[model samples]
Structures are given as C-alpha cells and as structure tokens.
Target: MRNVTDRIFQGAISVFIRKGLQATTQEVAKEAGVAEVTLYRRYSTKENLFITVIKNVLEKKFDSHVLEIAKENETEVFLMNIIEDRLEILSKNYDLVKMLLSESLRGNLANEINLPDIIFSSLKKGLEYHFELKNQTVDIDFCARQLGGIFLSYVVLPNAQPFNKLTLQEKKDIARKHAKAVLATI
Candidate 1:
C-alpha cells in the first residue's frame, strides 16, 4: 500500500511540476504506472492529490532533509546550515518550487491546504527556539519571515541579473550574508 502511495506521490510531484494544476489524472496515473481509476480511488479529486503531494512529499522532504538542525550546534553554524540546505534544495528543485509558488500565487490549490504556511511554520519555530537559547531578543517571527523572503527572492528571481549568474561559492556567500543580516538584528 505504501509503495503504491509513494509511486503515486512521486508521479504527482513530477507531473505537477511539469504541467502545473492543469496536469491530468491520466498523466499522473501513467507516470505512476497505475490505472487512472486507481488515482481516483486513492485521491478522490485533483486538489486532494495535489494537497497530498505538498503535505506528504514536499513538506516531508523539506522537514527531514532541509530543516533538520541539531540542538547542540552553534547558532551561526545552525544559520549557515539552514541557509545552505535551503539554497541547495531550492536550486535542485527549482522547477517544482517555481510551480508551487505559482500555484500559491494564483490561488489554484484549495485554501485549506495552505502550503506556504505549512512549510514555513517549522522554520519560524526553529528560529524562535534558537533565539531563546542564545538569549537573543530579536523579533523571532519577523526574522523568520525575513529569511523566508531571502529564499523566496532566489526562487522568484533566479534569473535576475547578476544573481542568476552567481557561482556556487557566490551562492554560499549570499547565504552567509543572509545569516549576517539576521544576526545584525540582534
């Protein structure tokens, strides 16, 4: 059951990224190597399938892979790790993130899914806790949102001017600058 679900999820992510919400269930079924009726049986609606992809696959991947931070890590180290992880994931999953952002902006998904809120809440919580541990009195939520904006800028304007042409080292430098920007608020 899990294997079937995973394949469906994998198929959905790829198809959605390639075709947006306009992607057909038949396409997803073919991508998953399952019948169209199986998709309907499992997901019920296109929106349901999209929400599942975001929640189960995209959000899960971000939490486990990108947002995992050690309690024992130093604050600066934590910041760098997070920024690096975010940038790497965003760079690698550029098309998917772009598609999700478009879906979010166009309000295509059902309102209840709220992908942005689901993805960012963890970052906000982590930042809030990290600040407390460091005895920092910064506005935790604002800082978290600001960092999110930094990531969003890259996603939205990846090909904007010199930013698009930055080498990997330059990208890391930008991440470092973002870390410093957050710390400067303290």
Candidate 2:
C-alpha cells in the first residue's frame, strides 16, 4: 500500500518537475499510470495530491538527499566541506536546483524549511570536536536565506558578468567565501 502511494507520488513528482504543481488531475493520473477515477478515489482533490507530493519529497530528501556533511578540518578548514558538498549537489541536480531557485524568487517555496539544518549541525559538531565552545545558537533560518540567495543570484546571473561565468575553482572560491562570511555570524 505504501509502495503504491509512493509510486503514485514519484510519478507526480516527475509531472510536477515537467509541468507544475498546478497541473491537472487527468495529467497526474496519466503520469502515474492509473485511471483518473482511481486517482480521484485515492486523493480526492488536486491540492491534497500536490501537498502529499511535496510532503513526500521533503521527507525523502531529508532522509536521503541531505547527505551527512562532516569534515576533519578545524576552524576555517570546515568551510570547504560546505562548498564541496553543495557544489556536488548543484552540479548533478542542476535543474531541480534551478526550479527551487526560480520558484523561490517567485515566492513559491516556504520561507525555508526550518528543521534538519545541516549547516548548524556541522558548525556545532565541528566546534565541539575541536574542543571549542561558546558558539551561539545560530540563526539557521538566516543562513538558509543566505545560501538560497547566493544560488538564486548565481543561477539567474546575466551572461555578461564575468563572475557569472566563473570557473569551478572560482565558483568554489566564491562559495567558500560566502560560507565563511555566514559562518562568522553564526
């Protein structure tokens, strides 16, 4: 039963990425390889279905997509871990990221999901492991905004900006610099 629901949702995810959250039930049903009546019986409404889809994606990503980012580097050395991991994800799932960033610009996604704040986790853990203390309870939300804003600006940058066309090393440098800037505040 759960697998059936997940399959339906996975199909819906593809539909959402290909189309949008406002797509029709008929389209979703077709995408899920189920009859329209079957879909309606299962979900009752498109909003229910869409929310379920979003919830499922969020849960799954939290469990699986958000990798455990840890580093042996003390102090500023922990910075590169943030950059390398994010760049890896951005490079592979560029389109999904593009979607997230674009929708965020249009005020689509939530004001950043609050839990599973891996950045804070990394900082606290790194600091403690390095035998340091007195770190404040960081504003995880603001850090989320900072990172999101960076990616959003980078993705939407005009073709003419040299920084927009930065090489991998330049990208890493910029990303690390931004991460360090935020880390200082946290």
Candidate 3:
C-alpha cells in the first residue's frame, strides 16, 4: 500500500512539474504505472491530487527542525546552516520552484501555494527569534529580504550552471559568503 501511494505521489510530482496543473490524471496514472482507478481511489479529483503533491513537496523541502536548530546555535552558525539548507532545498526543487515563481508573478497562485512566501517565512521567523535573543536592533525582515535575494540570484543565474550542479566546495563557499554578509549587516 505504501509503495503504491509513493509511486502515485512521485508520479504526480513528475507530471505536475512537467505540465503544471494542466496535467491529467491519466498522464499521472501512466507515469506511476498504476491504473486510473488507483489514482481515483486515493485522490478523487485532479485538484486534490495536486494539493497533496504540493503539500508533500513543501513538507519535504522545509525541514521541521531547522528553526529549532537555529534557536539553539550561535547566530553565525545558524545563519550558515540556514543558508546551506535553503540553498539545498531550492537547488533540489529548482524546476518546481521556478514554475511556481512564474505563475505566482502572473497572480495565478495564491499565498497558500506561493513557494517564496512559504520558504522565506520560516527563515525570517528564525532570524527574528535569533535577533531577539541577542537583543540586536537589526530589522529581521530586511535581513531576510537581502539574504533571500542573494541566495536566489546565485541559485537561478541564467546561462550559468544550476546551483545543484555546483561542486560541494562552491556551495559551501557561497553559504559562507552569505553568512558573512548577513553578519556584517548586524
């Protein structure tokens, strides 16, 4: 049962990433190597299937323990960890995030499905908490905006190598640089 559901979930992700919400259940069924009835049994409608896929993707990309780790660690260490984690998630899901970004820019996706808001809110809150703990006077919202912009510009540099394809050293260097920049602003 679990395997079947996993297949459907992966299939839905693949198809939706390729076709967006316009993908049909029949396409997903074929992609999953399952019957259409199997998909229907679990996800009554295409919208339901898409909702599940999006939810699962977000849950997977956003680490539940990230904020906890941020709260427990030193400010610089937490910023580095957050940078690395955010970059990794964005790199892994570049296509999905890119597609969602384009759609959201067109005012098609609401706040619920807006990937940028979902991804950055956690980081912003974590930064805010860290600043509060240290009694720093920094504006966390502006810091988050700057950090997000830097990370994103590097991640999606057109005509350049994709972030995920970068060497591990390169990623670490970028994360370290991001951490330094944030720290300097404080």
Highest lDDT: give the candidate number. Answer: 3
What TM-score does each of the candidates earn? 0.84, 0.59, 0.84
Q: How accurate is candidate 3 locally (lDDT)?
A: 0.78
Residue range 30-134, candidate 1, lDDT tens digits: 999999999999889888888878777566656764334635357767776677676667667788878877887897877655656765776776776676677
* Residue pairs with clashing backbones, model 3: none
Q: What are the lDDT scores of the predictions, listed in order? A: 0.75, 0.56, 0.78
Comparing 1 and 2 on TM-score, the stronger one: 1
Cα lDDT of model 2 by residue, 1-186, tens digit: 456676688778777666665578888878777788877788898767766666565545433423334324443445455554544444454455455545555655553432234334443444444333334454555655665555445545643434424577876787678778867766
Q: Number of clashing residue pairs in every model?
A: 0, 0, 0
Instruction: Give candidate 1's whole-model lDDT.
Output: 0.75
Q: In candidate 1, where is summed lDDT lowest over 10 consecutive residues?
A: 64-73
Preferred candidate (lDDT higher): 2 or 3: 3
Q: What TM value does model 2 have?
A: 0.59
Task: Report the C-alpha lDDT of model 3 over 1-186, residue by residue, as the tens digit.
Answer: 559888898988899889887789999999998999988888898878887778778866774566675675577788877887777777778888877766667776645676767767777778877777777778878888887887678556873676677898987887788889988987
